[model samples]
Target: MAMRRFGVAIVLSVILMAAFAAGLSAAKRGISVGEWLSVPFSDASFAKRWGYGETNGARNVISADRAQQRNGKPTLRLDTNSGFDCWVYFPNTKDWDIDLSKAKVMRGYLRSENKNGWGGDPWIIFVDMAGRKARFDGLKQRLYDAINDWTEIVVPVGADLDAKCAEYGWKAQISPGFDWKHISCVQIHQDTDGSGYTMWYSGFEFIDYAGRTIKWWLSSINKPDLSVTYAEQVPQYKRYIASEPDPNYNIPELVGSAATEKHWPNEGEQIKYLVHIKNAGFARSKPTDFVCMIDGKVVKKASLPALAPHQVTTIVVNWKWKQGPYQFAASVDTKNKLDEITKKNNTLRFKTDAYVLVAVCEKSIVAPIEQVNNWYGSFCFEDWMRGATIDQLNSLFKRCKYDFAPNGAEVSVRLGKIFLVDELPDDGAKIGEIDKGLGLYIFDGVWHYPLRAIHEWCDLANDFDWALNHELSHQLGIIDDYQYDMGPDSNLVNHKAYDRGPGGIMGGGQVGDNVYPAYADVDIAGFNLTKGHRRGFFGEYLYCIPYKNTLVLSIDGRPLADKDIEIYQKSMYTGKIEAPPVFTGKTDAEGRFPLANRPVPKDFTTATGCTLHANPWGYPDVVGRNGLFLIRTQVDGKWYYGFIDIGRFVCEYARGHKDNAVYSVKLMPE
Candidate 1:
């Protein structure tokens, strides 16, 4: 029976060896397995039986174990004298050459166990003998909880890795082809607190990582092949794919004021219109291939190096009409349709009807002073009118006549009394008055008053030119040089010299005192013109008017008592409607009421005109009775109010009124 059992065992052994040989023969060709480094620990054995120590080199030293008894376990126990410290050498004793060019990812598993080393964090270092030492610093510290267990860590070999390696003092000479040949040392460390720690480690492997490519293959069996390569294609021919739509591309919408069919500009006049192009989208729009066309003829093209999304660009385009009243449109190419079916890639369009009248260059003529008053007082009036050439004003009227006309009917002004008898107090009430009008208030007591008074009294015409020009500019939507005082001694010279630099309109006349105007002041005036209304008046009332057809007083569009409305009517019945009718009325609660219904007496009608007057109660200083005559007029089919000779009224009243004493006036027609 023993001989028969021995025979069966021999036969089974031979069969097993034969099967292994056949499996080896069928294996694919590759580098054969050789002596590779073995992991130092398998389970918990390293911490249970081994004793540890430390070396003077700051390395953890493990007491040597008997080679035969310990097997392949780490024979050296790391020392814990100064808390935790340990090191392991990945000896270069085998033919374990890694083909870095073919490897996709490098990975390993590591841990430590010394009780002290286990609690504190430790890092595993990979060193290359053929190159320099590369430190993957803080990598282990980040995985605090991940250290205890056998944790797998991987690193991809790409430009990012190359850049990182170079940044960390690694020798730059090593190219991407360099191999990770050796791990010179592995160590464990503890925090300054000296808490003991221990850990164990095992598995290490290199994975053939193929990220999205593998994911795609796994997701779809019929995925398109990505092996084909292409070179040199024009932008038009190439599939233009933008991560986002061009910001400059705008969808059609109403901006600023609503457009009305009747108010549209004439086709020829609309040829050149300014419109703002804003980037209302989320991405930048490159304007490399943009072109602007009018009536199918190219007028302007833009190459906006880059128009960031949400940024605004102002454009002036010609709106030409090809013999019809059809609307003109602006378009932009989004360059995005091929990749995704989206409206963003399509050309965006904005359309508006052409103008109604053709623009012609007409010679500049001085705007009638009356027309100037009306234009300045209108709520819709622009600051440009203060310095506009007559031609420009006419052109503006011709272009926006309808809009401007209605706004003119609502024109009004706020007047404050300036006392020349005594020094002005800087009380809140005076401050409030100045604040309301943002105008100058001159008193006669300042040391420089004599010089200022000479300019005011002798240069009446010049005063009209400078004072009226400056003050009216304020009423006309121009800004003040708030930096100047409204004292009696103030003159153009004082204004200019006060600042000791270049004098502006607010600086008075001395510094840049070329009687006409300073270049900076003129530039400011021009800017005010071009920019429309002043920035300061955005929320404030442009003008105040008595309600139409109501014989009541009004202030800032609100009704007040009759006493609050002051009227001044000119003497002449020139029959010239273009002139601002000499009419001024204060308001009462019910609304502004006509102060007089009768015509001016023949005696009061001077070579120029008749006069009318009215004044608010409580503001006795602003007496209305001093004026010579009252006049009546019709506007928009309603009886309007006016004061005939405001210049003469102011002059006479300034001379007669006592200092600090208030006076009142009323205009009753005969």
Candidate 2:
């Protein structure tokens, strides 16, 4: 799902502490005026319940004491003039520490100062003690379409919220181990256009459907005899067992895996996916068999335990994986064992990893190819190349087999078609471009350079070979990691989130000879193979310099120009400096400071400490803080700073390879 449709623009970053207290009891079986777990912003003191959260850039929020009168009611206000994003968090205060295990929905009221002035939907996040969060798109709740007055916002919590997360493609934001009982904090994030605007929020609460409203009472009484709803309510269970891509790919389950390191599933490995079955009916469900099928043949059938109303259970189905095309389907009650309402959702189809390649070249270039028959084979000379070319193409493509799996399992890449054309299409097609199914154009020189002038076909063959594999990767739906067309800037080549590691076909590896897809590249290709073309960031960052080796400073996505920078080692949690300035220097014309080959300290102590893993697969599935540092820079008479996680960058991304441990710091001005 496109996040823009939901209007959520903020990327939340905050570390919350733990909290626990007795919660209100659920009202017994009736829709009555029950006590609501709520935090009211009716007065300025509401600020005491909330704290300032993290932001990517400079943004500000006024203190709660500055509460303004809106619609004659005291409402808390936030202002953004920094042209950047920011957020505020409620850290599960003792007074508002309502247990969310029994909560059904989260409701609130919000208003904007100017009509239709909202930039995007605000995000409401629930973070548990373990840092696993349940983040939701607040657009639906905030009533974004019409936001003149105080609009009532409704957000489903628990299982209901999980379904909503899946529907909106927000499953990636949720970390594993998130539980309703351990909710430690709540954060509301917003976007800005640089032009200042005011947003007010009030009356935030978590309520239950069974105990709260008259609507719950009416629905209970008006039930149509036997109603049943079975579905994959959790986002984590919706797809094949693959790691979700990032707004922050640093999540441990993704980067800290063999799938990213050694690229597993070489010969024998198990392909796994989670199957969630929910009983959303009023009555309990009798035990039935859960059937799993591959290619329309039942492969696994297991007994399912009876489930109470609103209860959800997950079944793990796995098979020995091989490189090829496959179709997976699962059903809850294949034999119609449960006599209830409709069973339309009992079966579901899963995505598969399979691809075919088509190679084509122009006819005009064929004659020049025949003359060099001694050096090049006949298949390379023919107008519609055959024989040797097919075998070679298949070999090159099959090399991508290991990387093609989404998470080291389920993959296929086969050569499909080959042909020659009199003239390539001039529909804005660049040199070495491949259409989705249509074969790619194979010519050496630019459009202006005619094929008649090309005499040495064998010499151009190497470049053509590289282009062939590189373009084929694009046809499979992977994107280039490096940036282009930006003139005279050293930092223009890389992105801020460069964590995919160094050389790979999609990145720096293209400059070398034998090109193959990176582990990250293949993961993306596999995702597109099954998930279709959903909007997302795949290979998010360009390979920059090694961590702390060279500091490339940029502000507002532009090079900061010549400036002075200070570096220091600091505690990860508290910003307390553990050491004085390690190095101080002025940036060059491109805002780059060469650190004289100084490496970041590997033994520095971090807030969360560190764990050593022999290989990527052995790494724990939790993010840790090891070697964290502070970088302070001065640009245009103002100071800016940001933290760099050298320990994590090395452990997860670098993995002892300096070239793979690249990083660039972007500081926020004070």
Candidate 3:
């Protein structure tokens, strides 16, 4: 009996190995018994669902035929005669729209009719209802390496779809609206020279991954960890800040009044407090309760849905704008409904005032004041800032983690009043200064510059709003994280790849958005009303912003006043100093060589109007080395030397700690 059982087991093992040898491994192919949505070209009705188009006047014939079917299944055939390109598309029609949110892969079988194989590359594209498209190309060699027989071509359509497509040159506009919920269309392009070729395709299907079992180890000791990450107040009202007459405000009878009235939100305005809850655990969490309180009174109570591991959801609690200040608190699973990894972060508390007053510098002693008092037309800076800049600021603070590590506070600056003022406290009347106690932002003129370079030809703009946010952050106790000086360090090896720091608004205006994380130790920080005035927090300049630097040159305690200095930098490729100077300029009366506010050199400008400042620092096309420039000046037939390294953000070696740093050297006769 034992011998007979062993013989049967051997026969079963042989059959299983034989099946695997015939390419029947489900795990290898990511295939499972499931609901598969397919586009089988079994009949002529497929032509109705699919449309064909040509580019470069290409001639092509596409049809469904049973003659060249794969495994007795009808196949779609494409014959290319004479053109640069041709394509077949499943249009964005009502009948073809598919919900691919749960899908894992879109795969098909393809074969070439010619013995030597086809000469063109094949590509597939998926378009969402929002008109956003994701295209994947270079499949000629990838999918059909040797395709006299049917070859399998797989493209991931799940969460990793974009990443999979990106491996093979994906071209797509990524928008928040471009999601998998409604995939409207699918396209296949044949990119070839006007050569005659034929190809057949069959078994195009979308495989789902939802029902697939994910193997995860479970331990009785492990528990779900739920935490309230952060919270913020979102005001739901319209405000405008404009320095020009309202062009769209037309009330024919009250046109005069409409133009002058700054649209500020009034009392009793609706505001939503958003609480972010995260399941920061290895296991999924059960459905739980969320509670929100305002000034110790329960304002909202709602049930939260069950959350997967690491999933986060924001619960919104509505409130009306009341007079004075209010304290806010939120908690998840308040009743200890489920065991969690930790309960320390399950609740959060913060405070904010009902409204904040913003005083504008209408009359500046430094610059001319432009004001239009009449209702017919007026330069309304208040409305313009309220409408655009403040909204942008609030959006940034909603994501800001200030005064705390990891989970920062989100505070809102609700505009209470917009009044003109001639002066601000503590010299805040100076341009770019802001008094947080008074919400006063001193504006001199248009503040505009390139915050960062998106590419060689394009730069991201940092205008009035950027300067405002940076200054406002200072008032909120956020200290400048940028190094402000250039001190000598014998051991400091300035390399482009080595110089890296935490980049954000505090780090010398290196970011495009104000939502970058920052830290502050002052008592009154973020958008909170728990305030006691702390002096010397605002109006301070960053030690070094990107592309700008200031250096004081002196010798033997005497300034190198009005002297010509040459700037020479080492070649990144050769590691040798270039003979001809990159820039030569005269020092100021105080021997200050201010490299700030200097425009890109004409030599660095291309005919295409792109700046050659594409390297990490503002230097031209240096490959590896940091932008270290040597300042050389001749005095009494002797040369004095000093160095400044500009590589992305300033390194620890270059940090001099002084706002105005000095570099002094005595020229020696050799």
Candidate 4:
């Protein structure tokens, strides 16, 4: 019903183990001082201990179907339409007394079914000697602003009761000199007067004052995100059924599993929005105010009338913001304006873009458009679009779907038309309308955009498509996976935490080779799909080449020039080598080679081992005893062929996939 479902096994097992270790006194884990009674409303034996009946005693429950459940488990359900029903534990009979002196707070899980019943005044009254009652009225406002979601109730009793609550013990309506000791009964009453509502419940117990607080020591995995799998939630599923003991719970229940739809907007264009806010609780929502925020700023505010349980309503908000991706959030009463339970699930988030198409006709690529077409599969369109004609982009974009890479970012950009000089565009004003100028007007390198990519000489740079999508990715909010100079631990793109190596389009060298998006990227795009983690070595290196990190070379102090970086495998003992460059690529800016996992090794291994999944390739971090080396410069260029543990290098430099790390290497000049 909230952010994440817990691993029932871990929680249940831990409790069960603790109970066993504590030498549970044959009382179902009930401890001394206070007991967390498992009064399952469905368990006839337990219900008999604390009898259930209506206020009139004659009102008989027609059927058990009225009993509600969450995620399909039996829960406490009160249908106010039947009449004002009050149930008490250890009633006025005084046969069983609960000592509130030490066993302090009374807690229970509460939620309403009929949202319209929100205004219902629910109370927890503690009855002691002289038939005097001390009502825990502190929950009055909370019940009034209730939603149809489960929330834990912690009301003080006995010494834990504050001065104001103790004063209620001396009121006229209640007998004076109310005593906490020999407390006869505790009653849960809701008077909706036939306004008909429902509140599902679970785990009602009385424990020491120390247990009054609700502690949430949870992991991010328990919080469930786009990357979480159903298999990981098996323990939670099993635990629900065991605790709730509902046959229906045998089938899995889903919550907040809906994917978001992209809302494409235009730059500086005002638009009306109909945002929906849902009440996931049973009692009627006390008068509510809905607030909508965009990019952290409150863009719209509106008041909502009382809403029924599980009801939803839409509010209109006007927005006219600048281009790029936008993060939209709608919160139900962020302020403490309503008396409600938990504020956990009151807010929802969405992602969208405001796109524009523009052209840079400074100098068209000499090669055919086919080369650029291949980049689309590799996802370099954002980096290879520089100096392209508007017509060429039109053809390519027509086949493309709207997507953002580097996975998570809040920005959007539209491809606007770039006008040709004299014809309709220039640095100056023109008759035609151009919303914004794509200032990619200057570049000196020769680009043909052809399949047979050319090299300046013997050194070939992996500069293909870098100027286009690569440059634009920055504007779109995705950072380079390669950090210029950060340490391995601080590498944002490929850190130890990153298990999805060589699988995302956001990565540098390696990403360039594969030109792909990791599963996280797909999720960020709101696509319910997984391509599985792409696994393979760049050659015999046992992993994707130097892709996640950038290597800048300096020969005897200056940027090394006219040298190519070659990687190959060598024997640890014999120093024997495999001929041919496992990978061959030159550098840019004299000696900087930004790599990508490219030429996508033709012979991808089918033997499985690397990850939790049966991946065909070994783990990126495990490169075995076989030594792997990198040649700083080749062919009489002065640098000698040396073996460097590429795996250890990856462990060090290829850390984060969110930022670039430039590792500078100093070599002797030829």
- A best-first ranking of the candidates according to their lDDT comes to 3, 2, 4, 1
The candidate scoring highest on lDDT is 3
511-568: candidate 3 lDDT, tens digit per residue? 3223343222111122232222111122111112234345677777788899898876
**Stretches > 4 Å off in candidate 3:** 1-69, 72-140, 143-149, 153-299, 303-565, 568-670
Top model number, TM-score:
2
Candidate 2, poorest ten consecutive residues by summed lDDT: 1-10
Candidate 2, 1-670: lDDT as tens digits: 0000011112212221223211212333222112232234223334433443323323345444234554555666655443434555553121223357767766667766543355567777777655467777653434354255677666666666567555543332566778877565676766655455566777666677674621111011111111111112111111111244443323212233423432224344655656656654435678887888877677778888888654667777766655445676777777765643233346644333333334455657654443221111111232112222322333444443332232332333422333455556545454345332332221111112235433223323212234434454554434443321111222111111223245455453221223343323333333323332111122211111233355577788887677777766433233234445656778788877765544321212111122222221122112222233456776667777755543234322323343433356777765
lDDT of 4 at 394: 26
Which residue segments of model 2 deviate by more than 4 Å? 1-43, 65-72, 92-97, 114-117, 139-148, 162-173, 211-670
Model 2's TM-score against the true structure: 0.29
Each prediction's whole-model lDDT (CA)? 0.27, 0.42, 0.45, 0.37
lDDT of 1 by residue, 1-670 (tens): 0000000111111112245443442342122221121233222222221212222212223333333122354333333334323333322111123333333444544443333323333343433434333334333442355444444445443235565444432222333434554322222223323544333333333334452111000000011111000011011011111121223321111223221112222334434544334333223444533455545556666543345533545455554433332333333432321111111212222222211111111112111111111111110011112222222222222222111132211121111111122322345685445333422211101011122222122112101224433443343333333222222233211111112135434332122323323312322322222231111121011011111113433333444454333333211222112223334554444544543333311111111111221231111111111212233433234443322322222222323321122212222221
Model 3 misses residue 244 by how many Å?
13
Tell me model 1's lDDT, rounded to 2 decimals.
Answer: 0.27
